[model samples]
Target: MVVLATKVYVSGDAYERSRDALRSLVDNEIGDLDVEYTIGVREDNFAIVTIEGDDEVVARNVLREAYGEVTPNFEDGETYLGTLESWGEDGIVLDAGRDIEIPADNLGLGQGTPIQIVERFGLVQHMPLRFVYREGDGNAGASELADEERDRLYDWTRGTGRVNVNSATRGEVRATVNRAGHANDIVTVERLGLLEQSIVCKEGTDPPGLLAAIGEYLPAEIRCVIP
Candidate 1:
């Protein structure tokens, strides 16, 4: 059994849809392998997959590479993925089978308070982020946002700006944008995670304006990345 680093925090019918979506995603990743797998979610919302068969080992590695893993023990200096939990004056908190707090200085996105950085990067709650773990002396481990993760967030700014959202699937966000009559305002809806999405704006579309137009349609956290 392996706990996936990403989460399934949506509830009710949305939860069921997200699970089915996850099943399809997993099948697409490892269906060719000779393995049988069962998907489940923990009380904390992290997904768990149990695999067995001749090709289980290879399938597990494939899943780990695709979604990262949440383990009881995190190897020092090893990079892992976690869901954004909260941000404050001090730093940000992430849930990776455990709550790991990454300090402000270690964010590595630029000079700003953690909350400011969160706003600038449009990091919605429950969005998965990659980080390098640093075990403390006889204490829980600490983490810093990984370079690749930083680069990805930085690239978002270099584009025409975007509206990042959580607790909604990519299809749902796209539908919301269409329902709000801004379908042409977006270039594409990028899937950040199972339930996290980024709405990439067209050249002339204002990300914040698009966010405002569609915010009423989504009952989830939405942040705009202005370029």
Candidate 2:
């Protein structure tokens, strides 16, 4: 069994739709192989995938390559995917099975407190982020966003025409955009987390315009990443 790095925080009908979407995603990734798989969402919101077949090892490797795995223990100098749990004056807490606190000083993005950085980046609660773990005294591990990773995320905002939506499954978001008749405005919807997604706007399309077109149907917080 392999736990997906992404989190699933949606509930009710959206939850069921998200699960079905996840299953289809996994199937698209490794269904051609001689393996049968089952997808389950844990209490902590991580997706657990169990594969059984003679080619299970190959299927497992394929999944690990596509989606980072959620392991119980993390090693120093290695990067892992973690969900944003909470933010405080001191730092941001990530739920990576264990709570990993990233101090404000370690956030090398720019000059700002944790909360300000969260706002500038439009980071949604429960959104998954990549972090590198470092070994500290007593074998405790400290995780922080790498400078390169921070730059990459920052670059996303540098580009105009991206709508960042939170608290809705990818399926729901896509449906809303289509139902709202703004499907052509979007080039693609990138999945940031299970419930957090970024809608990449096509050329000549404004992010705010796309948001306003679909906002009425989504019933979730939608923010624009203006350049």
Candidate 3:
């Protein structure tokens, strides 16, 4: 079983839809392989995929490549994936089967507290981020956002702009965009996690304006990334 880094925390219909979508995604990821798989979400909200068959190893690796895995151990200086859990004036916490804190100084996003950077990057809660793990004293561990991950967030600012949202599926976000009559204002609805999404705005489109137009239609938290 490989535990996925992303979370599926919403309940009822949302949970079912996310799970169905996730299953379809997984099917597409390993459809060519000779493996049978089943998926489950742990109490911690991390997803686990159990694979069995001749091509299990290959299928598992494919799943890991598509969705980073939550391992039972972390080697010093190695990179891993974690879901954003909470943030404060000090820093942010990631759920990697355990609490992995990336303090403000280590965020590498520049010029602000952790929450400030989160806002600047339009990061929604539950989004998966990559980090390099460092072993610390008394069995404690520390992590910093991986260089590639930091680079990815930095790239967002160079784009037209985006509206980050949480507690909704990609389909729901897209529907909200259409319902608000600003469907043509977006380039795409990018999935950040099972419950997190980014609405990439088109050139000359205003992300804040887009957010205002669709915010009321979504029963979720929304934030804008202005360029």
* Whole-model lDDT per candidate: 0.90, 0.81, 0.89
Cand. 2 TM to true fold: 0.89
Candidate 2 residue lDDT tens string, 167-207: 78777888889999988888888988767898888878887
Worst 10 residues of 1 by lDDT: 135-144
Residue 223 deviation, candidate 3, in Å? 1.2
Estimated TM-score for each candidate? 0.94, 0.89, 0.95
Tens-place lDDT per residue, model 3, 1-227, is 88988888988988899899789888999988999999999999888899999999999999899889999899989999999999998788999999998877778898988888888999888899999998874223557899999999999999999999998888889999999999899999998877889999999999989989998888788988988
Candidate 1, after superposition: displacement of residue 169 in Å? 1.1
Best by TM-score: 3
Best by lDDT: 1
Cα RMSDs, all models? 2.1, 2.5, 1.9
Candidate 2 ranges with C-alpha deviation above 4 Å: 137-141
lDDT of 1 at 36: 96
C-alpha lDDT of candidate 1 relative to the true structure: 0.90
Error of 1 at 210 (Å): 1.0
For candidate 3, list the clashing residue pairs, or say none. none
